[model samples]
Structure formats: C-alpha cells, structure tokens
Target: MKKIRKKAFEPIDKEEKELMESIERDEWRPVKNIDQEKKKAMAAARNTLRKDKRINLRLTQKDYHQIQIKAIEEGIPYQTLISSIVHKYLNGSLTPRS
Candidate 1:
C-alpha cells in the first residue's frame, strides 16, 4: 500500500494544482540522459549570462542623469539598465512609449 500526503502550501492555480496532483501520483519520470541534459542547460545558461566585453560610452550630462534616475527607479545599476535596454532593443522587444 502507498501512503498519501498533503503539502504544507496549496497550489496557487488550476495548472499548478494539476501538476502537483500528477507529481503526487508518481506520474512523472526522470530523463534518461540526465547528466547530458544538465550540462547542456548549464552551457546555455552561461552563454545567456556572459558579458565579457567592455566599451567606452559617451552620454550627454542630461542623458546620464536621466539614465541614473531610471536605473534607481528600477532598483538596478545604471550600467545594467543600459545593457538591458540595448539587449531589448536588439531583440526587438523595446519600443518608444509614443
């Protein structure tokens, strides 16, 4: 006989509840090539996060102050904010509000 158990916290949504129920029923199985999959995922994560190059940038005083203010509002460093903006623009996800 198998013992049933309840989780400390409830699932937050219908999809989450279904996933939790399936997991509790032992419906999921481990991947066969787990080590290889782990290595590939790690490599992809490293490539995504890599920031190995640097460049000297010039900005007007007003632009610099505005960037700093925006970064502070977003709770990130100004350099990170600039990097994110550039990345989003290159990926075609950033657009002017107007």
Candidate 2:
C-alpha cells in the first residue's frame, strides 16, 4: 500500500489575527454601565414581587382531570384554561348560562 501524505495547516492571515485580538480585548470590558446594572436589578426585583404575590391553589384529581379533558377538547393547555377563567372572573365577564 502507498503511504498517504497529510497537508500542513496554514496560520490565520494578519487581518484575521488582528480582528481576533480586538475581540479578545473587548471581551474584558464591563458588560453594562452602573446605571444599567441598577435598572436591571430593579426590574428583576419588580418581577420577583409580582411573582411572589400569586396564591397557590389545590384541585381534586377528578376536577383536574375534567379541566384537562376540557383543555384538550379546546386545543389549549390546562394552565391556559385556568388563566382564562381567572381573567374572566376578575373582569366580571364570567356568567352562568340560563
């Protein structure tokens, strides 16, 4: 069998090398200003507050299965159905049909 020769790998060109060096240097810079960091922290805190204010509720297995079946029939997730129900109730648009 004849021996196969491998080609030598070539180094990157000058412009490519300089571009890589610039990227490496810029990577060490601070990602955001102090004011931007503060604003981000405040936004995160507000989100946490909003999430924490929610109440946790429990449902019987039979009720949950019924809701899941209705959600499947409606082509929506059970959580979406719960959210719609809550929204309608809060908005005073939920009414029992005669």
Candidate 3:
C-alpha cells in the first residue's frame, strides 16, 4: 500500500504549479500595455542609473578633506570615489597591503 500524507507546507503548491504551466504555455501577459521599443530604452536607461539608492555616510573632517583632494586629482566627485572604493572592497577587488 502507498502512504498518503499531507504536509503543512508542500515544497510546491497548486497555484505555483498552475502559474508555471501557464508560463511554459506562453499564456502569461503583462498587466500593463508597455511599449516594447520605448519601454526597453527606458528600462536600459533606468538600469544605467540604478545607482538611485542612497545611503548616509559619516566621515572625519580630515579623511573627508583627503578624499576630496584625491577626487579632485582623479577628476571625479569625492562621493563617487568613496562609492567605488566601497564597491571594490565589497567585491574583493580591493585588498589591504601587508
């Protein structure tokens, strides 16, 4: 005899399965009538400007001044330089020298 059981939460549910089937059948449609060419261009522009998220930063006056000097030398904004350094460090591209 086969065991019949029901778990509180199935790994997958019926609605999810139905949605997957619909997607596989290409029956899914966008809720909004977005223009392909125009929306695609706008999407690309939005992605390029995805740095829209902002955060508060705290720095000592001396460090801030030093960073400003470096930014001036690099011909970029201080905030941009700081963001780049943070990004590199987080991605493991920047390392502390021994």
* Number of the predicted model whose lDDT against the real structure is largest: 1
Candidate 1 TM-score, C-alpha based: 0.63
The order of the candidates by TM-score, greatest first, is: 1, 3, 2
Best by TM-score: 1
Better of 1 and 2 by lDDT: 1
Looking at model 1, report the run of 10 residues with the lowest lDDT sum. Answer: 2-11
Ranking 1 against 2 by TM-score, winner: 1
Q: How far is candidate 3 from the true structure (C-alpha RMSD, Å)?
A: 12.4
Q: What shift in Å separates residue 43 of candidate 3 from its native position after superposition?
A: 5.1
Tens digits of per-residue lDDT, candidate 3, 28-61, equal 7775656776788898998976787789988999
lDDT, each prediction: 0.96, 0.79, 0.85
Candidate 1 stretches with Cα past 4 Å from truth are: 1-32, 96-98
Estimate, for each residue in 7-76, the C-alpha lDDT of model 2 and write its tens digit: 3543379886676667657855665588999999999998855633456779999999999999999999
Clash pairs of candidate 3? none
Q: Over 4 Å off in model 2, which ranges?
A: 1-55, 96-98
**Order of models, best lDDT first:** 1, 3, 2
Clashing pairs in 1: none
List TM-scores for all candidates, in order.
0.63, 0.42, 0.50
Name the 10 consecutive residues with the lowest summed lDDT in model 3. Answer: 3-12
Cand. 2 TM to true fold = 0.42
